[model samples]
Target: MSDVIVVGAGLAGLCCARELADHGLDVLVLERGDAPGGRLRTDEVNGFLLDRGFQVLLTAYPEARRALDYERLGLRPFYAGALVRHHGGFARVADPLRHPLGAARNLRAGPGSLVDKLRVARLRRRLSRASLNEVLEAPQVSMAEALRLEGFSREIVDGFFRPYLGGIFLDPALETSSRLFAYVFKLFAQGEAALPAAGMQAIPRQLAESLPKGAVRLAATVEAVDRGGVTLAGGERLEAGAVVVATDGPEAARLTGAVETPAARATTCMYFSAERSPLGEPILVLDGEGRGPVNDLCVPSDVAPSYAPPGAALISATILGIPPLDDDGLEAVVLEQLRRWFGAQVDGWRRLAVYRIPFALPAQPPAVLALPQRPVRLRDGLFVCGDHRDTASIQGAMVSGRRAAAALRGSDSGPSCAL
Candidate 1:
């Protein structure tokens, strides 16, 4: 019998198990999927690595820095700032603070006014310097309200914040808590947005590799989890010293029968293989108009050439709403829009995949933000953790897992549990 049983082999479950195992505890991780990485999985198609969605890791995340080995991931970084598409041209908004530039040129031509850029920089500085507790517990408000309170003009809000940050949080209205905005804003400001050369799955694979031999058991569907232990799909109960439910919010609720899962954010990601590169750099392309089906676009191969086969480019477009058409129909619609942005050259791009994720992230409002995120400690030996329990980012997921391990350590002293 294992000392600890963790349900879900995603980053949270994997990280929690790693922590427990590191402390000399026998940890058993059960995952329903054939492989790990609940939402962060990757697929290989025709020699191209396609992530489940457009996801990137910010190196500034404390948990990520402490838990992950970035060097081994062969990190590929995107160009600083953004490539905002407004009317018929692209606007560049490089980090003036980090990458020194011709201030006059960028101020007059970037997404927002000079004052707006300065305000963004100031907030970014504060986020990078502030303590986690101080930021999370700071007075809260809607992200929109917070931006207005900071005196951001309508131009900057619409051009940069609306499409850019809106796409990130899946909240175009900016109804998310100001604290979340602050946390994300800090990440972007302080660190480069990047992906592993191998794919997002590499992160989880590394975590699982750190565990003991046969520590993780995939294809083990968990029906429920309680103080006693976890029950498999066939009503097989695997009793253990403690149990941790680290699945997504909805699945967690189903297994525990106690959590009221919050509303979730949805998105549609479409991938296309182009004959040639559209944009030169791996910069994020956003629709400032706020009406097109494309919320944001990126050519992953521009930064990490390995994402696509030689001489080909991979274009990923993320839409805020699900497209109401079949794969062929949706592909046609996406290509039509791409032609507008890149001209007639887009005619040669081939559609690769269309992933519409309904539960991309948890809808975190002020109330959800105020809740204490941790082991949750359902009873004496049961607990829960995931990005849903905290912020909806790789950082949050890993941090919540660490919190669960801490709770497990505190609840009982280290020792082997009798079978």
Candidate 2:
């Protein structure tokens, strides 16, 4: 029997287990998957490292800053803005403060009126001054409503925010909470959006490695959870002083007998190999026309050379929802779309992989966004934590994990880092 059992070796479970083990508690982490990363997984196909779905880490996360070593991760940064394809042409948009002289020029020539650009700057300044919790706990509304109320014209909402923010939030309709929108906006303002040079899976591996030897047990599936302990799939039951259900929302509900967990947002990402990159800049390319399945595109090798072998380039395209077309048909459609923007060089791009995640993120609408997020200490010895319990982000997963560990030790203070 262990002092504490963490059922899942994802970022949440690893963080919580590390917290407990550091306090001299015997922590055992069980994972059904062979690897520790849940959705943050990466695989080598031929010579390319492809993440499960397209994802980026924000350096501004308070929990990440507190718990992780950035230098060790070898963080790689993307450009401050994007190249948006609109009206059969590509236009650039960058934050004026970040790019200084050039962003204003792009804003003047891109989509959205001068008034819309001014309102965006004003909103950025207002949110940057607020505390992290203040922004999170603020009253929530739909992103579409927030943009409209902020005095941005519909043209800006559709051409800019819909495709740009929608790619980040995984909601093309902008139905996510304004609170999350503002929080992400502030993060973008404060720090760079980056990826670990090794791949996204490197994050979970680093977190799990900090624990004592034998702390993590892979291929161990928890069939059920009770007050006593968890029952493994092979029929053996391991008792513990406490059990932290750190699985995703659906699996957590299944183990703990909880009902009505939130639904997940879906996403599809396709990886491609090319002779040469269509765009050389490291900025994300957005489909401002919104006339096709492609939402946003990027080349990992453009940002970090390690993602692909020395000579080849790797490109990734993200689609927010599952469409009716099959994988082959979808690729055909996307290739035709790219041909228009980057000329016929796109015809040579080879399909490397396609990843469709139906449960990419927990849905964070207005009500869920407004709910006070804290670790669920089911009882004195029972607890649960995941991105579902917090803000539905990498930060939320690690933060919830740390909070669950604190609850086990009867401490209310989770992380000391302040944003």
Candidate 3:
């Protein structure tokens, strides 16, 4: 019997287990996948490290930097600026601190009119100081509706938010809650976006290494988790003082008797190895047209050369929609987007890798105003954690897991049921 049993070796589960172990409590992590790092994973196929989708860390994500060791991972930084790709031409919005001249020049010449440009600057300043609690608790409002109230034109909204933040959560409808927009806006305003020299997987892998040996059990699918503890697919039951369900939102709900709703959005990422690099830096490039398979593209090799072989660039093309899990339906859409974004450059491009995560992010609509924060103490000794209980993101998952551990830590001091 373990002091604590955590289901799902994703970031949340792993982080929680680490915290519990550090507090002198023995923890065992059960993961359904063959390895840890659930959504934050990387696969090495055909001489390329394929991340599930193009994911970058915001330097401002409080939970991530505070919990993980960014220095040890050697993260490669991308520009604070954004490269907006329009129909005929493109414009690069340089970092205000690093390149004031570029910033001013783009402000004056960027696609948006003078009024819309001014509104953007004002909005940025306001978002910088916005509190997470306020945003989360405030009445639910859609991004589009909120922006319109803020006096932004359709052109500006379509040109900017649709392809940029849309690809991040894979929601182009822009119907996400205003709270999410505030949180995201703050993240973009305050910090630089960056990627690990190795890949996004490095962050989670580093966290896992900090734990004791045998702390995490991989490829151990969990069939059910009750008060008695967790029952594995193999019909093995493990007893524990407490348990944390740290899978994705839908899966977490199923395991913990929480809400099981269809995910808000799905992400499709295609990796193409091109001899010629698409853009100079690893800055995010958004398509202003707002209608296509290729909504955005991130050049990972530009940020970290080690990601690809010499002279070969890794182009990550992203599309936002809930496509079928099948390769024929999924790969076809991703490949079409690749050609649209890269043109003939992607023609005959080496098919390095492709990944489609169906329930990549919770469909955090207005209905999902807020999740239950209280730790679900279902059986005599069981608790649940994961993004399902909090907002959707790496930071949310980590924070949720930590909160679960805290609840169990308090319970341990109170009582222990004998079976």
Judged by TM-score relative to the true structure, which candidate is superior, 2 or 3?
2
All candidates in order of TM-score, best leading: 2, 1, 3
**Deviation in Å, model 2, residue 335 alpha carbon:** 0.8
Which has the better lDDT: candidate 1, or candidate 3? 1
Highest TM-score, which number? Answer: 2
Please give each candidate's TM-score. Answer: 0.95, 0.97, 0.92
> What lDDT would each prediction earn against the true structure?
0.84, 0.87, 0.75
- Sorting all predicted structures by lDDT, with the top scorer first, yields 2, 1, 3
The C-alpha RMSD in Å for every predicted model, in order, reads 3.7, 1.4, 4.1
lDDT computed for candidate 1: 0.84
Clashing pairs in model 1?
none
- How far is 245's C-alpha from truth in model 3 (Å)? 1.2
Tell me, by lDDT, which candidate is best.
2
Cand. 1 TM to true fold: 0.95
Tens-digit lDDT track for model 3 on 265-318?
777777878886878776878888765677888778888887888878888877
Comparing 1 with 3 on TM-score, the higher-scoring candidate is 1
